[model samples]
Target: MRTSTTMPPLQALRAFEAVGRLLSFRRAGEELLITQSAVSHHIKQLEEMLGVRLFIRKAKSIELTPEGAAYLERTVEAFRIIAGATSEMRRQTARQRVRVSVLPSFAANWLVSRLADFMLKHPEIEVELEPTLRLEDFASDYADLAIRFGTGRWEGVRAEWLMNEEMSPVVSPALYDDGTRFAEPKELLLQTLLESWNPVGWELWLGEVGVDIRRARVLQLTDYNIVLQAALNGQGVAIGRMHMVRDHLAAGRLLQPFPQIVRSEKIAYWLVMPQNRRLRPGAEAFASWLKEEAASPPSPVC
Candidate 1:
């Protein structure tokens, strides 16, 4: 017996494979969008070229012969391998994109303002920003990295210190100019307290200064962004994180009424990524840029 080096036609193989899987020439033709006669013709050509009977034709149905069953198994595996290789190649091509998850307020006040420089530096990389209050799952492909505000400890991930937060009372400069002496922490209670989340920062800061806020008029908001906006509009006084409000204070849009700034030992900004996952080039580049940006002092208020 002589073996042929040349393989059979791809169209004939496809016709046979589809018919073998579906076990019906009519169904394979419907799947392949061809006529049932075309499917039968291709299978007949394939059988004649290979000198083998692949399927037993019946009046209403067809069944694979012994040779057909063995060939179908190999053909299906070959198609599966081709599909897997194609998917892997597509993923490699998309590696230039980096997805970052961050807090809404942080993204609005800090990252958005400075993101342009990073884009300028690495034009090849594309960044996708996802801002949400909920902690993202780094173990999955939800994000390439996350900038979270917390103590630098999380299970199953590597957390690197990004920046420490300092909280201070910020008021619109117009409010400060009204000559309502806010020299004392207790004085803030006289004005509406623009609060975020639990309003715990106000209580923490007041306790540190031995001031009571039991009677303070409060307007609790959903997030820090709204709180800061309320304070900027002179609606109330808000506890502003130093990193978030540095530009506003520097530009004289908002004023720190007192010199006291409180640091939270429990919460700070951190860069988190899954420890077991390797960083792709785009992720690595963004992470490095973030660290360098964090280490530098805030730009002088201009």
Candidate 2:
């Protein structure tokens, strides 16, 4: 009997797949949760094993070689099949657990509350929620489905809308109490704090209200959720995503003071998976459950 030494490492295959799909090692690193150097090293070891060039590196970007491109397509399919089969096997035993990745704010404010309903409906299947801002490669990251917010244009992935998020201005009770007059959107520029995640937000909001921002008191923030917290603490008025702020608004922690607004460019939350990937039993169950959840409220965009 002879032992074979021909099998490839899964790590190398994963690195190659991620980089080939994204066409950039830097981006692949973000998805894989590894450094760029680590990505390169994995690809290097893989190339050494196969004795072939996998990627053509340019000054600013990377392009997959013909072999790498062909390999990734098949490898991605392999992962999907494996994930699907494993989930199916677990489902037969009535002990299936699904992994769902979503943004932090959504996990805390929206999905966590609704999860109980899903569990009650499908008691056998357990859902594990992972909060992340970075999108994961389902194959490598072992996530069953990803609830992501974007324009829904990921290459090689299928996306279904979960909900549309509308935007409005929200402020703490103190801001209103301090007599900061936001009689008009323009007046907001004079006295209110423009808490921003991406700088374009204020611009977009101002454009919606037909105000050109010459200058404003701006507090640059990294996360929109943080801005929301700051607003709740009476720090400033932050632009709020309507769905996430619904509870706060209802509870009087935050108030929508004006009707003048911008429709968010941040349109929809989508459940995304690779188009070629075969969804596992858990993944399929979770997707269906999410669809049901999205439909129950009958949100216009879901």
lDDT of 2 by residue, 77-97 (tens): 998999999988865988688
After superposing candidate 1 on the true structure, give the runs of residues whose Cα lies further than 4 Å from its correct spot: 1-95, 153-157, 177-179, 213-215
RMSD of each: 6.2, 19.1
- Model 2 error, position 156 (Å): 4.0
lDDT per residue (tens digit) for residues 162-248 in model 1 = 988887788898786787777678888789988777676787677788888687887889878999899999998998788999989
TM-score of each: 0.65, 0.64
Give residue 189's lDDT in candidate 2 (0 to 100): 73
lDDT of each: 0.87, 0.78
Q: Report the number of the highest-lDDT candidate.
A: 1
lDDT for model 1, on a 0 to 1 scale? 0.87
